[model samples]
Target: MATASLSAFTRGIGRYALVAALAAVFATFAALAPGFLSGANLVSVLVNNFALLAIVAVAMTFAVSAGGIDLSVGTAIDFASFAFVSLVLAGQPIPLAALGGLAGGALVGLFNAVLIAGIGISPFLATLGTLFVGRSVQQLLTNGGNPVYLPPAGVPEAFRFLGHGSVAGLPVPLLVAALVIAGAWLVLSRTRFGRVVLATGIQASVVRYSGIRLSRVTAATYVLVSAIAAIVGLILTSTVTVYIPSSGNAFLLNAIGATFIGTTFDPHGRPNVPGTVLGVLLLGIVANGLLLSGLNFYWQQVGTGLLIFSVLAIGFANRKAAARA
Candidate 1:
């Protein structure tokens, strides 16, 4: 009984470790980094640094929770950006252009689904192949990676609102991120589909034996992830008013890392929406604080790596101790 009690206590600590780490990081920055807590800087951290990443990380959470990973998430992002910019430049209305972009992203998801589910390819290799093919296709489409720029004057106000405008004095991107997070939370916590997803990750054989169409579930999971990624593509293109080939790849590694970091918060080490959001916030704080502290870009990355490693290491240690107890 004592061992069981000790195990429960350790598990509790593991679950809340990320929260504690976030507070420590914030307090450290607020004290050591000038402007870290200033209103403008705080807003910038949420909107400019964290919003898009949080979205992408949430998208990643879906794939990770489903016992798979989407290496071609950036492929969806780049394709969506390419389509949105091209459609807008062709003078289509913003709504139509946005739909086109979403459709383009869905194509990547479809291809991945067919490869991984229908054709029985491993998720990692299939998406990795998709990533390579996607990069090449974009390069070919852009005549060697040249950026497609939108006419600044011609960008519609509605589209710009997604990236820059505010609602109730809160940035639009922040609101959008919140909506995605909330929706993801609801689906994962309250729906049959969500239960299947979690079960699929934990025990695929059991799920298959239960007569669920694993293939359809797998396909839908990839589609959902890509669809979410497409939203970020649109927001990013709208913000920059340009489509740069492969620019979406920038968030790929970070999203993966953030998602994994979030798993540490789950007692079973499962990926979850709330944990992923907290992980993204932690990363955003570290990034902004490091920049303010005058760390070079490379060193900033080193710091981020060290932070992730430390968090995971500690979490794993606690998890093991709990098991032993």
Candidate 2:
């Protein structure tokens, strides 16, 4: 058992590419500016992008690992925030309000599951439809295309504490993100479901023939992904003074960028959660770094896109070479 576990762990490590990319980026940034690594600047990037990138990237890892995609993730995050905040402002209890918020996102995932797993609809089409559905509902709830301001009452101290509070000298967001990474690693490496899910990713037909229940797995994966995304929304709502109905729309591209980051980090055929965390932080640093250095947000976008493309190209080339061997 020990030998087998060690082998699998090593294999998992081998599949990742994000760590190398991270090292390269760090070197480049240090060469570009000594102030880039300033304590305040690094901490700022972590606090800003840690929650968004960690949740969405991890969720997307599951989706891509299963050969499915959840394009509605951005909408899911926005709608969740909109729902939760609206409920709180309406005098609902905090826990119930959070649940209500999560429902908006989870229901979308269930819809995707039904269409893709039950009715045999394409994953792309199914999620695309929910993307609009969730976004439209958010708009309708906010009265036809306006971002709503959320009230501060009835939001539990714990929820607010999670975003602003610190633990053992670490910010709550960073602490939570670390826990998430460890949890994902345990689930992906130490559980039967993880093995099955990844196996299904490699070949669903093989798993089915091996007596795995495809439908149940498919539905469950979507729900889990949706829930993970929902957590991200809750974090955003907690941190921001006001919740925006469409705040997550900007993250759509970022999420895809994160997916490529995940793929890059694991170019050897493994997905690297820690590397993903690094990828998200690096992306954050680029924006925050440039802005601090007097660059505008518009140029930040172009630079971010180029950096992501570079990561993807290098990873793809490495993967192709490995395949040929």
Candidate 3:
């Protein structure tokens, strides 16, 4: 009886480990960093550090929840940024350039979809190929990878607004991130198609037996993932006013880590929007706090890596204990 009770206790701790870790980290930062809890710093963490990663991580969640990983998410982001900047430089209107950006991202998705859904290639292999091809293309386009910067005088106020402007007292990027989170949550948790997607992820053979067109669903999912990732590309380009070749890859590792960290929120270990958001927040706080605590960039990454390892280790241990019990 005592052993059984201990197993239950262990499972409970494992289930809420991520949340507990987040709270502990927040308190640690608040105590250690002088301005860690300052309103301005909090706002900066949310808008600057958290928003873009949250978006990309959420995009990753879709692919993961569907039983796949998108190694090309960064590729999609780069394509969108490339297309957006190229069009803007060609004197295209902002909206047109934005559309072209989305199209660019969608094209990457479509390529992956064909390779995976049509040709029966595994998602991992398909996306890895996309990433390599995308990188080579970017290098060729930029003449061995130079950044394309918008002329300061030619930069549009509207473009800047997407990155830095506020709407109703909230940063625009934050607002966009919020919408993406909410929309993804609703789609994954509420809609019929979302249910089907989740179900498909669990067991494609079973879903296929139920007369669902697995290939169609998989194709749509890759496209959705890329489109969602493109939003980050737009915001990134706006914020930096430059398109740096392969720069979007910077978010890839963190996004993957954040999405997995978020799975700790679910009893069944499913990837979820809320979990992803919290994961992003935890990393964001850790990053900002470490910087303020005088840690260099490399050390900050080590800190983030350690934090992720700890949380996931706890969660996995608990899962094992629960199984033994």
Model 2's number of clashes is: 9
Scored by Cα lDDT, where does model 1 land? 0.89
How high is each candidate's TM-score? 0.95, 0.87, 0.95
lDDT of 1 by residue, 163-188 (tens): 88889999988999999988888887
For model 2, how does the per-residue alpha-carbon lDDT over 35-77 read when each residue is reduced to its tens digit?
A: 8788876786777856667778777767766777788788778
lDDT score at residue 12, model 1, on the 0-100 scale: 59
lDDT of 2 at 269: 50
Q: Please list the residue runs of candidate 1 whose C-alpha ends up more than 4 Å from where it truly belongs after superposition.
A: 1-10
User: Model 3: which ten-residue window has the lowest total lDDT?
Assistant: 1-10
Of 1 and 2, the candidate ranking higher by lDDT: 1
Q: What's the distance in Å from true for residue 221, model 1? A: 0.3
> Per-residue CA lDDT of candidate 3, range 283-310, in tens?
9999999988887778888888899999
Error of 1 at 202 (Å): 0.5
Provide backbone clash counts, one per model: 0, 9, 0
lDDT of all predictions, in order shown?
Answer: 0.89, 0.72, 0.89
